[model samples]
Target chain A: MIAPALHLDGSARYDGTPVFSDLSLRVPAGEWTCLLGPSGVGKSTILRLFAGADTGADFDGSFGADDGAPLDGRMALMAQDDLLLPWLDLRANVAIGARLRGEAPDLARAEATLARVGLAGMETRRPAELSGGQRQRVALARTLMEDRPIVLLDEPFSALDARTRSQMQDLTAETLAARTVLLVTHDPAEAARLGHHILIMGPNSVTPVAPPAGPIPRPVDAADVLGAQADLLRQLRGLPE
Target chain B: MSGWRAGILSALLGVAVWQAVVWATGLPRFILPGPGLVATTIWKSRALIAEHALITMTEVIAGLILGTVLGALSAVGLAASKWARTLVRPMLVFSQAIPVFALAPILTLWFGYGLGSKVVMALIIIYFPVTSSFFDALMRPNRDWIGLARVMGASPARIMWHIRIPAALPGLASGVRLAAVYAPIGAIIGEWVGASKGLGYLMLLANGRAKTDLMFAALIVLAVFTILIHAVVSRIATRLLERY
Candidate 1:
């Protein structure tokens, strides 16, 4: 029995501002888990914390990955900003993580990954040359190159057009099939789109509020989802009052 | 568009007025040669003017390369370590404060009135602007970028090499342009103070021999050379920064 990737229990803050506190969650192996919250609820910070991004004393947590799981090196993270190297083209950017790890045949794999994103011809175009959607796709392609068990995605497709965003979600679902994916996003539609178990980050904490539990066959339809996006939005809206 | 054109036309008008003043006053050729006379003189002495111009241009290019390399290296060094910044920063600022005219004489005394002295002079003139500009650019507040890179576990070397260096391009380009203008001027000044060759030396020699035309020729050559260098460097940098 391959156990889950992580069991988290803790809190984090910023300059006396409570980001989220006393959070607990279980991220299983080979499953997509989306963390949903409104803007500034420290969803990104949790992704950061999970990715070992905590600087200073902002985080208090208990995180332990399953032993001997054979993750390719370790955790790989993607952030909200689409932090692709501006100097690199699509191909080079995709392979950067593998190159960092001294992985064999990095560029070849990076090229194939870029092809998966339909960016085959844009291997030489820099990040500044790419559109918002293209850049995010390139970033997703890059994250795939890491070949790691855990992939932390932080609002990666938030800037894309609806069509592109849905297509990207489809591509990511197909391509990142086996990874323990933790995606930080504000949009419930997106969380529903990913069709994973959900972790909703709350005012003072994050609670394990999975999407009705058990396997929900993904490429999930908006109407067939357990939580309607409008309901979630209203729930979020009514929380602080 | 009209405003820019008008400003340029006004400058040409100012030049025409200056030309008229020189002609009407009948000022001594040594004191203030007329524009027409200078133009004719430059045409006549173009070959000789070009030879001296090449010498000055070469010196300027060499000094520009050396000073920029030294300045950028110093900026990196200072940025890399607080100890180096403490030790070297005061000297750099103080060096800029000491009048270039004052420094020129001493440099001539040390490097013996030749290429070395002139190169050092050019270096002294353009070094501070480049060093300070690049230093400030390199250290510019990039909290988001720093946070991103740190979270990604980028090594310090990688962070500086990739992030800081590319981010500093705009400031570095401005500094390069400033240095390009001043580098030739510095070389000319050094040659004016003491040199066996170059347009500045030729201008002085031409003046002594009462060849006012030849002196004007040298001055025009200097102008063309400065424009050419600045344009070329700017184009190359812009192309390189396409990726940046």
Candidate 2:
């Protein structure tokens, strides 16, 4: 699949306060771009803008695919909350997008995706019956089942413990390799681990930082990842590097 | 203890207390029938009481089914549209402001002194709780679930049916439980206003004829029937909550 480049030139205001003004960025096709910032720097807002999910914000933007076609129905967003329906079991939850689209749920494919997310044999368990990490995995499976060309993630693995978070990061980086991805997170190390190119959003500007030349998920203890992590942290703290 | 055992024990204790009260009061059987006299009356008039009880039961069941269907639909309508909420909801609440007992005569006047009047009475009494409880639940669906559904491009109708309704079912179940207890009150009140063949009418006839023991027997039968209906509704509600 030839992934389309996403371009955005936008300004957004929340409650009459400017979040970002005249902000422009280009995401190359089929690459992972991580948006890293402090807690309230509007990283997730940018992702929401791309996903068209920020309905209440005063946003003025021109967004388009590289081919000049509309972007509707081509993007899927995995929000920070694992918003699994409480009434459905894991399999049905993963298949919800298909069901919502009025298509027959591909249960066999849903089961395979659940297994890929390491949620095998728990297809009958509801969200409330699972652990936090397990629920997050189910949410990930749901996003994967969407099978759209562009994916937006908002702090997708923040709920997982260290080991499971690493596993999920690796799995996502592998599974979503062929799609355009824009991820939002506050974790510098997570950005370093998964992002092919990292964009740091400061109070006034977004700065692009070069990461090490390796496919993610890079070894957490790898020398290149650690170096990029340090540089990312330095940029976040407003230090010259 | 399990529910049945506990219920049986409580009932036996209530009967013992009633017998003690009768012995202590030394009231005459005409004005205040003893437990023994009431018990004998119940056995002897079993056939008459059953006939009336069956009629009352039919009215209560019919009213419950009709009211629940209408209430559930009204709640869905209220949840689905702001216009419905603004227009219909106020009228529903206003209907309750005039006491339901007051409406019994009006309903009897409109529906006539038959099952129609009694069923409408029960329906009127039950409508508010079912609509209110279900509407509250539907209006406040889990925000995260709604967000996810929106992101997935679910239509508003789809979201309401697939997500909101299923999520709000426990609240609907609670409403049904309340309706079970209230249905009989509406039926009996309608019978009191005007009816020919129901427990309420039988009680009134026995009292007018100064048959205190027979009236007590009819009243006891009504009480037991109410408890049984409540138990059945509660059991179904519990199962629904568990499944969904």
| lDDT score at residue B10, model 2, on the 0-100 scale | 90
Worst 10 residues of 1 chain B by lDDT: B144-153
Interface RMSD of each: 3.9, 1.8
Each candidate's root-mean-square deviation in Å?
A: 3.8, 2.5
Query: Could you give candidate 2's per-residue lDDT for residues B175-195 as a string of tens digits?
Result: 999999999999999999999
Tens digit of lDDT per residue, candidate 1, span B128-216? 88888989999893755665555445666667776777778777777888899899878988998998889999999998998876787
Point out the worst 10-residue segment of candidate 2 chain A by lDDT.
Answer: A48-57
Report the C-alpha displacement of residue B134, candidate 1, in angstroms: 3.5
Model 2: how far residue B123 lies from native, Å: 1.2
Fraction of native Cα contacts reproduced by each candidate: 0.10, 0.40
lDDT of each: 0.75, 0.87
- DockQ score of each predicted structure, in the order shown: 0.19, 0.52
What DockQ does predicted model 1 obtain?
A: 0.19
